[model samples]
Target: MATLLYGPQHDPIHIEDRALAHLKIVIATKLRRNETFTLSWKHPEAEPGGRSTIWIHPSIPLRFVFDEPEAPQINVRWVEELMHTANSSGGIMLVDEVLDIGEIERQH
Candidate 1:
């Protein structure tokens, strides 16, 4: 699992390393453009066991920490899908990569 630390107080958002790798790309792209988006995800069991959303912006501090030393394989399809959602007014929603990341070698 990987943790996305967005703010100072909120607990880290835990996600699979493969997904986080892809997300890093999507997020960096947006931030590079000075675009802000909301990232929403269902909390892990260790968290509140519900859903959470965080406003992501270029000015805000953020970090991505992976358990593995090296980055995992990134699915281009997943990045496109995530970028699509991030462009929407509703913002980026974390979905199962296996369902959308077609034709890419899944890092499982």
Candidate 2:
């Protein structure tokens, strides 16, 4: 399954091999321009809080291995689902769902 890190803004960021690479470039560009972004991920089955969110600056190094498992697919339907959940939170809530990264790339 592909691992995806969502933002507090409810924006779904799909990351894969080349997509991850492209994202790194985009992140670098944004950081170079002094932009900041918030990112979140699940804590895995062993964790207590269930999930965690962090504000990622431009300095974080991102690396993806081709041999790693592919991420799950993320589609409009998934976005709708997330929106539904986010809206119900009363306040803005961020979530990270595993997505098939290839799906996003294929659609493009």
lDDT of all the models against the reference? Answer: 0.84, 0.45
Models 1 onward score TM values of 0.84, 0.34
10 residues in a row with least lDDT, candidate 1: 98-107
Q: Lowest-lDDT window of 10 residues in candidate 2?
A: 89-98
Off by over 4 Å in 2: 1-34, 65-108
Question: 1-108 in candidate 2: lDDT tens per residue?
Answer: 223443344443333443343344444555677766644444445445565555556555443344356543334444544444433423113344335679658768
Q: Residue 57 in model 1: shift from native, Å?
A: 1.3
Cα misplacement distance, residue 92 of candidate 1 (Å) = 0.5
Q: Candidate 2, residue 29: CA error in Å? A: 9.2
Displacement of residue 19 (Cα, Å) in model 2 is 13
